[model samples]
Target: MSVENKKLPQSYYVPAQSPWPIVGAIALFFIAVGSGLTIMQLNNSNVSGVFLLVIGLAILFVMLFSWFKDVITESNNGLYSTQMDVSFKQAMLWFIFSEVMFFLVFFGALFYTRNLSVPWLGGASNNVMTQQILWPDFQSFWPLLKTPAGDTTQAMGWQGLPLINTLILITSSVTLHIAENAMKVNNRRKLQTFIGLTVVLGGCFLTLQVQEYIHAYTELGLTLQSGVYGNTFYLLTGFHGLHVTLGLILLVIVYARILRGHFNDQQHFALQAGSWYWHFVDVVWLCLFFLVYVF
Candidate 1:
């Protein structure tokens, strides 16, 4: 009953050994090294590190493209099996778990800043000059507005662009659900429509996010260098944006495979993985909207 049971003598489905994954690992190594050196050089006045970082990132992208192309080709050739499906599902689940841990680091930083760092700065402990030296008028609140460095910024409320983006992302998750359900029922037209709509909605959410960033940086004068608040804000939200971009790319690939008559009703691991990623992104955005913007 399995796809592999219908195959030929060999039990190998996509038995090809890919060199690109190893190349990608190498590329990431260079990128990490280059980035570390670049940051060090910024303070030490050394310029060589940035060059390495750029080269590493370039190689990494190339490796990723080549590797993804190979997988796509193998998948289209009907070389995947139920075992492959389980593997993909496990991979995606672990991937999302890793992402959750990544965000937890930022959330930990936020908690430290709010509950400890800011309080210490305000002379909560035995240090009297802490208040005299810095943040004399600082009030410690959950959604930080006045930074310890005396840089003031208006906290982004949840009612405007943030709310709209939240709704858009939630709607996208729903549309992706519809697409997955359509795939289950073997409705290619409905699948394509829902998937395409979800992609468009994702694009719109990203565009709005860009606009919000522009407003924050330019209009509101709240930049990454503003203070600790800006640093955490940008780090969390910017990384989320990058994930959304990757999720959209995955959705596009699934849509392309659908059009090529791939991913039958009984076996569509690619679509399922992409849907999981999209939903993960959406849930992260929801947390960000409440914690970062609304508090």
Candidate 2:
């Protein structure tokens, strides 16, 4: 490659037009509508929501496959330059930032429920009827044990399974970082070893997480309908687990590409993006460990 080809003006930046975005948007629309209808059908017992949700997810998977294929084709064709690398970096940064905001929304809601809503219901401020008429035994506290409806559950502590998962995720993040740095330095053996270790560690964390959930549900009698404690606990951890699953999938794709001799030392944006995503998932798990498990 010529040095001139390595650098290009921003004005020359042009990506091929693709229809995947529109298709993805349509799929999401179906998902939103289907979920709404499904919730509304809770009492009537209709099944349209299930059908729509499945179709929407299938469309989404198709869109992802098509879009990723196009990208890989472009990369293999040598159509991308250093400017494209910069664009990928910027795009990944913005994507992670958006995800940070997504988690922040949920965390904010958790905080609001714990600090505001619970107190108001317990008559901490003005309304004495909050205690006199409703919830006479309601006690406002973090890692809420009881819901306003009187359902109770034991809070998940930070000492056992959660702490182990936290350590596992953190170690995976470190190994992934080592793999990324190895890639940058063209240490292919080290890169493979680190990435493989990272993948194994991630799998371990997920396995432990499932065990924890089982212990919570079966051993501790904690369940989704147990109360707000169970609700928030599941919501936060479940969302984080979904992200971890996605990160694992991305890592697997990168590993396959590596085996195929696809990415080079300097041109491994997909690998870097996957690493960033994995690390982001790890950090989110840390926050969840502190807030959800540790209190």
lDDT of each: 0.83, 0.84
Off by over 4 Å in 1: 1-14, 26-60, 125-137, 142-150
Q: Which has the greatest TM-score? A: 2
Score residue 63 of candidate 2 by CA lDDT: 92
- For model 2, residues 236-278, the per-residue Cα lDDT tens digits are 8988997898799789878877778788776899998999899
Off by over 4 Å in 2: 1-13, 29-53
Clashing pairs in 1: none
Candidate number of the best lDDT: 2
TM-scores for all predictions:
0.83, 0.85
Tens digits of per-residue lDDT for model 1, 48-152? 898888898889778867777888788778787767777778988999999999988888888788788878876788655877777567665555666555667
The true-versus-predicted C-alpha distance at residue 198 of model 2, in Å, is 1.5
